[model samples]
Target: MGASERVVPEGARRRRRPTKGGTVLSEQLIVETTLRLIGEHGAAALTVRRLGAALGCDPSAVYRYFKDTDELLLAVADELIGRTLNSWRPTGDWRADLRALGLRMHADYMAHPQAAMLACARVTGRRHEIRSVDAILGVLRGAGFPDAEAVRIYHVFVDQTLSFAALDASTLALPVRARELEARAWRETYARMPAETHPHIAATSGVLVAEMDRSGYPAALEMVLAAAAGRLAHVRSGPPGA
Candidate 1:
C-alpha cells in the first residue's frame, strides 16, 4: 500500500489524538508553569529536569519549545512585560502615565521577587514588548521630544526601572544565611567608621537605617521622569549656541 493509503493501527491512532485536557503543549503553558514553579520554589530551584517533572513531561520537551534556559528566561521576561503593560493605563498626560507605569512595574516585580533577578536584563523582542516601547516613544514625541531624545529616554526609563526592581527584589529575597552575613557586614562597616572622619555619615546613620523600609521606588521614578522632562524642555527652548 502507498504511504498515504496505509492505515494506522487502532491503538496508535487513538494515542495520537489529544486527551480532553492534554492538548499539545504550548509555549504559554511552559511559561506559565515556569513562573508558577519560580514563585513556589524560587528561581534557583528551577531546572530543566525539575520543570519537565512539574509539567508531566521529559526535559527534552522543553527544548522543543525553548532553545535553552536563556531562551526560557527571555520568554519569562516578555511575559512579565506583558503583565505590566496590561495593568498600566496610559492617560493623556505623558509624565503621569509614565510614572504610573513605572510604579506598577516596580510593584509587579516586587510581587514576583524571584523572577525579577532572572528577567532583569533580558530583551525578548516580543510583540507586546515592542508595542510598549513604541507607546512610550509615541508619548515622548507627542510631548515635543525629538525622536532621538525620546528613544534615549525610553532606554533610561526601562533600564532604571527594571534595574531598581531587580536590585530591590534581590535584596529582599536574600537567603537567610546571606541575610545574616549582610547584617554582620553592615554592623562591622558602621563600627569601623570613625565619627570625626565621617561626621555626616555618622549623623545620618540612624535615619538611613530607619528609612530603609521606606518605598524609594516611587521617589526614584519621579526623579527620573522629572529629569527627562526638564531635559526635553531645555532642548526645546535652547538654540544651537545655547
Candidate 2:
C-alpha cells in the first residue's frame, strides 16, 4: 500500500486515515494490540514484525501509526493509564478515593508487570498522562486543600504510587528462576533470622514470611495515604491566620 493509503496517512501519526482494501488500523487498534502482546509475552515481545502479524498488516504499516518501537511503547503505556482512569469513578471521600486509586494502579501494574516496569515512571506528556495529573489534583482540591497544598500533595501521592508500581513491576518482570530465587531468599533468609542477633527481624518473621509471596504495594500505599491524611488533618486544624 502507498504512504497516503496507510493507516496513519502521509503527514502525521495523529491522522487515522485507513488504507484502501487493507486491514483498517487505527491508533487505538494498534495500542490495544500492543498491550495484549505485552500482557501475553512480556515487553520483549513487541516488534514491528510481530505487531504486523498480529494486526494482519504489513510491518511497514505498523510504522504508519508510530515512528519506532520506543514511540509505540509510549502509546502502550499511555493506554494503560487511560484504561485505568477511565474505569475509575471518583467517590466523594478523598482518602478512600485516593486509596482505591492507588491500589488499582498497583494491581494494574502487577497484571502487566513488564509493561509497567517499562513505563510506570515514564513522563509520556500524552493525553492520559495529563488526565491522570488532573484527576489527582482534582481530588486534593476537592478535598479542601489550597492550590499550593493540593499541588504538593498530588505530587507526593502520584510519585509514591508510580514509584512503588515500578519497583514491583521490575521484580515481576524478572525471569522466573531469578524471581523464584528472590522469593526463596525472602522466605528462607529473612524469616529465619535469629532472635538474639536480630530481635526485630525475628519478631516480624511471620509477617515477613507471609509477605514473601505478596506485593508490599498495599501496605506502602496505606502509609503514603495515611501521611497525606495527617497533613490534611493538620491543615484543617490550623488557627485562622497561622
Candidate 3:
C-alpha cells in the first residue's frame, strides 16, 4: 500500500507519528527532544518552531503527535515522573519506600529545573502518573489503612513532594548570581537584623544563615511521612469500624 494509505498496526499507533520532509518522528522522540531543548537552552526554547527545527521537520509535524503545546508539555512532565518510578521496586517497608520515592521525585525534577518550573504543578493524567497514584495507594493500603485514609495520605505524600520539588526547582533555575545573592540574604541581611527590632529572626539567625540556602524538601517529606504514620496508628487504635 502507498504510505498515505498504509495503516499503522494498532500497537504501533502510540509510538509512531506521520512523517514529513523525510524525517521520521514519534511521540517519544518529540517529548525527548523537548526535554533536551528545555535542559540545554531553558524553557524559553520550547516553542513548536524551535522543536521542529531540532527535529528537522516542519513545525506542524509536532501537532500530528500532540494536540498542542500544552498537551505535549503534559507528556513531557509525565515522562519525568515515569523515569523516577520506572525501575523503582518498592520494598515492604512503606515508610522507607515512600521516602525513597519522595527523594527521587525531588532529585529528578531539580535536575531538570527549567522543565519542572513549567510542569511540576500539572495533572498529566498520563499512564505514568496513574501508575504512580496506584502504587502509592497500594503502599498505604498494604500498611493497613482503609481506602479513605489511604487516599488522603496519598494526596499529602504526592502533593508535598511535587510542591516542594516545584519550589526548590524554581530556586535552582535562578541565574548563578541571583542564587548566590539569595544564599547570602540570610547571612548578610537577616543575620544582621537588630535584636530589638527582629527578636525571633535575630535569635535564630545563626541557624538560618547556615541552613536557609538548603532545600527544605527532605525535611518536609519526613514530616509528611511521620504524620502519616501517626494517622495510621490512630486508625489502628480506633474502635472496630469506628
Candidate 4:
C-alpha cells in the first residue's frame, strides 16, 4: 500500500488539514459545524463525509478528535447540556431553581430541535452530563431530602425533562406544512370528533383545541416539582431512619 494511504493509528494526532481560506479544524469548530448542518438539513446530515465537506477537510480527520460518529454525537449532546447549564446560578430556592433550570433546558433543546431529537435519550457520560448530574443531585440534597429520595427524584426530574424536550422537539422538527397539519388536527379533527363515540373528547374539544398545540413541558415540570416537594415533606415528617 502507498504510504500516503496508510491508516492513522487510533489516538494518534494527524497533521492539520492544509488551510482553505485559513480555516483550521478543532473539536469545537467541528461540533459547531455539525450543529449548523443538523439545523439546516436535519440529523441525517451528520455523517462524516458531509461533516468533512462542510469543514473543508478529509473525513478521516474527524476520527482524530472523535473515536467514531457515536462519540462525536455524544459530544454534541454534551454541548447542549453545557449550553443549558452554562453560567446557571442557583437561587437557593429549590423549587424555583429547578423550575428555571428545567425551562432553560427545554428552551435550549427546542432551539436546536433536530439535534435534541438525536441526543435527548443518550447518556453522553461526558463532562457536561457529569456536571449536570452533580448539580441536580446537589439541588436535591440541599433541599433536605434524604439521600435515597433525592436520588430517586433526580432520576425522575432529569428523565422527565429530557423526555418532554424530545417530545416537543419532534413537533418542532417537522416540516412547516407537516407542523401545520398537526396543528390543524388538534383544532379541526379532535375538535370535530363525534359526540356519540368520543363524548369526553367532544365535551372538552374546545379546551383541547385551545391547549393541545402547546408544549406540555411546563405543566409536567410543575407536577414533578410538586411531587418532589410532597416527598420531601413526607421524609421530613418521618423518623430519621424511616
Q: What are the RMSD figures for all models against the true structure?
A: 6.8, 3.9, 4.4, 3.5
Q: Which candidate leads in lDDT?
A: 4
The C-alpha stretches of model 1 lying farther than 4 A from their native spots are: 1-24, 180-194, 239-242
* Candidate 3 structure quality by residue, lDDT tens digits, 1-242: 12243334436544245445454677888899999999889887678888988887777656656766778889999999899998688998999999999999889998899999888889999999999999999999999989998999899888888888888988888899999899888778999999999999999998988777788888888998999999888988998764
Candidate 2 overall lDDT versus native: 0.81
224 in model 2: Cα distance from truth in Å? Answer: 1.9
Q: At residue 40, what lDDT does model 4 achieve?
A: 93
- Cα lDDT of model 1 by residue, 108-132, tens digit: 8888889988888777898668878
Task: Please tell me which predicted candidate would have the highest TM-score against the true structure.
Answer: 4
- How far off is residue 105 in model 4, in Å? 0.8
lDDT of 4: 0.86
Which 10 residues in a row give candidate 4 its minimum summed lDDT? 1-10
Return model 4's CA RMSD, one decimal.
Answer: 3.5
Q: In model 1, what is the error at residue 18, expressed in angstroms?
A: 5.5
Q: Is candidate 2 or candidate 3 better by TM-score?
A: 3
lDDT of each: 0.79, 0.81, 0.85, 0.86
Over 21-40, each residue of candidate 2 has an lDDT whose tens digit, in order, gives: 35577788888888888878
Which RMSD does model 1 reach against the true structure?
6.8
